[model samples]
Target: MSVDDGILEHMFESDFASADDKTVVAAIEECARAEAMLAARRLAATAELTARYTEPDEDRDHLAVDGWRMASAEISAAMRVGDRAASSQMCIAMALRERLPKVAALFAQGRLSAALVSTITWRTQLIVDSQIAQRIDTAIAQRAGEWGGLSVARLESAIDSLVDQHDPDARRRMREAAQNRDVRLGKRDDVTGTMSLWGRLSIADGELLKRRLAQLSSQVCKDDPRTAGQRRSEALGAIAANAEGLSCRCGSPDCPSAGQDDPRAAHFVINVITEANAPNTEPVPATPAESATAERAAGPVEPATEPQAAEPATERSKPRSAAALIIGGGLIPTPLLAELIKNGAKVQWVHKPPAAPETGYRPSGKTARFVRMRDMTCRFPGCTRPAEFCDLDHTTPSPAGATHPSNLKCLCRIHHLLKTFGGWGDQQHPDGTVLWTAPSGRTYFTHPGSRLFYPGWDTTTATLLVPTGPARHGDKGAMMPRRRRTRAQDRLRRIERERALNAIDRKRWAAPATTQPSRPPPQNDDPWKITTDANIDTTDTDPAPF
Candidate 1:
């Protein structure tokens, strides 16, 4: 029988239930080896496909824009993955094929797991010299089979040490990470009216923000019921809305901060869409003072602040018992929604979609807002980037593609680049549906993300008819934007700069301390300063009698 037939027969014939513990353990090891071999095969195939699409020309470097065009898109379609993921896979595949042949061989021999290979490739990516890379690869492969038990952190450190030994400059030193500091608001999860905050800030800025939050949290009266964490969260919100301070909820009549108008009260505008006659749709009192007094009479209450606008909610005329939708936040509980409106929050109603598509090349504000509300996220398949952060791409290049809602769709910058230069094409339909054609000729269909949340609302628009002819913005002579410095050049410069800084620190640390010279005796003043062997007193040999 062929190898495939034999493997299938063995797979069916295995009787794990009848096996002893030793046999079970051996079987598990065999399965792990098989998994590694399978992963190697997958990477090999990916490498082959990438080579086919991104073959280099003698006149131009493969690293240039032209060679990699459409390569990632092809991989993305074949693997049914996002563009970023496909590009990462391609990088790993190329690294194995061209730079780390020894490690790749170990992977193919079922001795190294996929995770280990990934870590090894990433840790050694800075080694620009092929000779050094090969040396490190061989060194790693020789012992990688014994590293199955190592955690991810340990594995990375082990690989890094090897690279550092061979080429100290190539060691991955990411001191520039502070330059990438950012803050992000997470999508709402199951928690009602709450979302998580995530951020990476400079050390100084982070400490400052933390101290500021703590100070604000302490502004509340001692009897406030909220926990420290909750108080901090409220304080962050207060800072975001430019509010004066958190209101004290101690229910004390003589509280000093009572009756003070919140400067932030008018700044908070909440957009909520609800059925006009929906039950329990009571509005909060018109003023913060009135709302606070009412809550006090009812006993201690949860801290209240003006609600920020919910992301645009789906408009529906029919009455239903569904909870109110906060535009960007998520679902708000009915009681909480009522309380927010009572706390001097401004309410704006979104009753319907934009009336019509605009005539200008750029979409009007109304059209842009409507598109964001309808799509909710990027229209690219498997991409979940929020529409608010995406560019409104023209399905067909503009002028040929009108500024109509049907022709405009949300695409994050990366995916937008793919459609523009990566040989990917897309069609946008009247109902916010997108049909994508990747470089590999596979097609994917995606609908407006809002359809999943607001099923009853209509997102349909006027149908756009694509003109039949050559594209106005064809990619005949297109080139991907070149970087100021290539990745290899940038890596070399960064390594040199960082190593020089390190050398300065090392020299300072290792240098011997300077000693002050002994002062000379004053001229003709102290005879004890000069000593000679003859001047020693032999009479002192006898012990002194006391």
Candidate 2:
């Protein structure tokens, strides 16, 4: 039987005063289901429409852009949505149609919501093997309703777990993808002179940056009113200025303030997780540029011929510089890494597994730095406010909650208050992800920003490795003050240069030893020569005869 419109009207108007607790709760859940049903219908229509459009307008016009791109452009123009968003939606729709028939059926029936199915569709594609993908599809379809309440992090983790369990090569695939990390620095804008930064980083390199930034961010002056982000911005500028003052103009990582006035600034650390095991015959080039050039110059790098495969695994830790590329996520450029090594960067191998649990109400300065470095930013859903500006919230609540790194999280002031007073609830996992529950019971999750891309990162080596390099480019071994050139020496050099130039000028103007070529005597008699009166030498008796 169809419920009367008057019932919903009454539910909204009465605020559930006339209804029991069960009735109100049931009504809310049913409403959510209805909305999800509507979304499912819309996505189904979208899939059908996209399927028909094998060639979009741009394709017919000889623009090789994807068909969905043209559709996204039109959608953006008509609906005021971003083109990127539109294209993504179109892609999801097509993927669901082709790869996820069970999910598509569930969505059509409104048993599974479009949003939740989209999350499943997107993540399941990570399983490269079709058999593994089918297994995951079956697993998710079996628990469709249960998966709906899961937060995004939980859902992704669940999918990743299944893939790893089913696919033997999952770890290899992840490491291969991680190797493709890169950093991009955008051009400064004309109006603001501000550029954007975005990149993929290996966990080790990214953690180092966070630790450095946190240490620098803490160097605030009294009466400073700048925001946390502003402080970090200034700290970045200070890094450059500090290096400049050390006269370390060589843009090299090894020389990054190699010989510096400040010992503290010269010290840094990095963790060497693993090293390349090349045979004793040919060593690998240290930098990417050198590797490329060597490949070209040497006509492709030859593999190590003699295998020391007989060598024990224990010998790998001895470390004879096969390049640090494996550990830094390929994000740090070859030049920078070479410079760091050049300046005596302190290299430490990661041997520890994980940090011991701590139990304090308030975190120590050291703990706070580590937590900030680990988290990198606020741990609220979709909130990217830097952890520097955030409060360290106890995920389980303080006093009753232990002061462990696993228990603590960075929450911006606004979110901290919302969790403290607002109807939101959260639970932190051992892996540092937070499962957040809204007042209405919708679940979401936030994870430590730095560690997201690298799931298999060595937790023991998560702590930063500081490279105690030289203070300046030339400052190797001991720190020594360079002697200044005296004014007398400068003057003497200038005098010598002046004398050398004067001697050259005098020699250039001196007369030749050989006699100058003699002019033909009286060529005017030869009509063929056509000598003019002016051409006749005036020096020769005034050319009177001519």
Candidate 3:
């Protein structure tokens, strides 16, 4: 038997849910309206923050002592945005506050987007003349509603057209900018090993480059399954490989470059880790099972009588008859793996686990390997960041926390910061299931690898928390383990204290209009893909002024 009267009276958060579509839809709309209102409030807050740190009178306290740099840094740290992005947002917020009242009113109405306002700001900033900039902003503000439903290209083009008409020197400025054409390569970000290219080119040069890529891409055989994007990528690679001339090679079975390595070209290398249990035979699944690893998954390996450190690169350079492709921890077709192996690159095996003591605070190389293998991806509930790519967090904190499976979990950088600094909480069970409790007392749960892939081994353990009560014969408080409060816990306490200091009104922050106009679904009926120069990410060599 259980009883709670006074304790329950202090609560408002409920566990009830409605299944009716109408009720659910109404709830969703209510949440959306509240969110729109919150967005307006958030903007207002940002504007206030900016004003505190910014000054029109350069001589008076110089805009909050810490200035725009400190202000943007504080905002970015609190809100988790890039510094440049935060500065840009602050600029727009300030502009709306001082210069664009009509746009600010539209924002208060909460129909237009922050992104759209930012876009208009970008357009107006291009006009160096203050009066012309104001004129352009006024025009755009008048047509803000019409600006909705337009693609980024059309919007940009429209803004450019207005600039062209209003400012005659804009054309001359563009011609001058065109003269400073250059290109630079960015780092590879994905499994495909494609690098980001940044540059500006003259109109004629840009057109020529496009025409060549199109011509080369069109030459692909009708039987080929490669998409237009893939073909274009191949053409670009071909161009980069030998810039003076172009090659029509697709690297398929019949292609001339299928078996031959070009002396002057670079291979697109994929870092593939070989696992013990994956099937390397024909007709292998496109994605390998999560729990397929066995003792001999990487195949037969005789233990060396004398232990000698082996280099991974040296081992990879050594050829093998077969390999199970754990490329980016994703399932790659055996045929595709074989094709890649036939080329210059081969699958790389994870180094043997390091032997580390149990009580150590830090994870050893072996522990890292084991954790990566066991978790496969970040253990933060709902996060999919590869465990290999994430930081291993001591779930219970170090010194008090041990370097064991139950004590350790993977968390991506942002999520790790959020957990350590933003009042988030996590608890791990022995079976590799993580229960995450948010600041609002809401609990979420997730397991190791996807059970859809790993059939029999996964545990279906995502469940809500149940309250605990201690039965007492006399007047005694419920006993619990005393844990050292973490920074997150302190943050939680601060939030509670702040809430207690202010009068709690549930509806205060959720002010909404009587009715919100229903947004029309995008009609993608226009079949032909309409792309423009703006879509091309020619991120300039010059650092952007936020």
What are the per-model C-alpha RMSD values against the true structure?
A: 10.3, 30.2, 21.0
User: What tens digits encode model 3's per-residue C-alpha lDDT throughout 115-215?
Assistant: 67777666554344567656766776788878877899788777667765665333122324765789976554634334567899888999999999988
Quote each prediction's TM-score: 0.70, 0.34, 0.42
lDDT of 3 at 144: 85
lDDT of 1 by residue, 412-456 (tens): 887777778667889888888988987667898889876777666
Stretches of candidate 3 exceeding 4 Å from the true structure: 1-101, 107-115, 124-140, 149-154, 157-331, 341-362, 373-387, 413-424, 431-546
Local error of candidate 1 at 410, Å?
Answer: 0.7
lDDT of each: 0.68, 0.53, 0.53
TM-score of 1: 0.70
For model 3, what is the error of residue 238's alpha carbon versus the real structure, in angstroms, after optimal superposition? 10
lDDT of 3: 0.53
Which consecutive 10 residues in model 2 have the weakest lDDT in total? 304-313
Candidate 1: residue 212 lDDT (0-100) = 91
Query: Could you tell me which 10 consecutive residues in candidate 3 have the lowest summed lDDT?
Result: 303-312
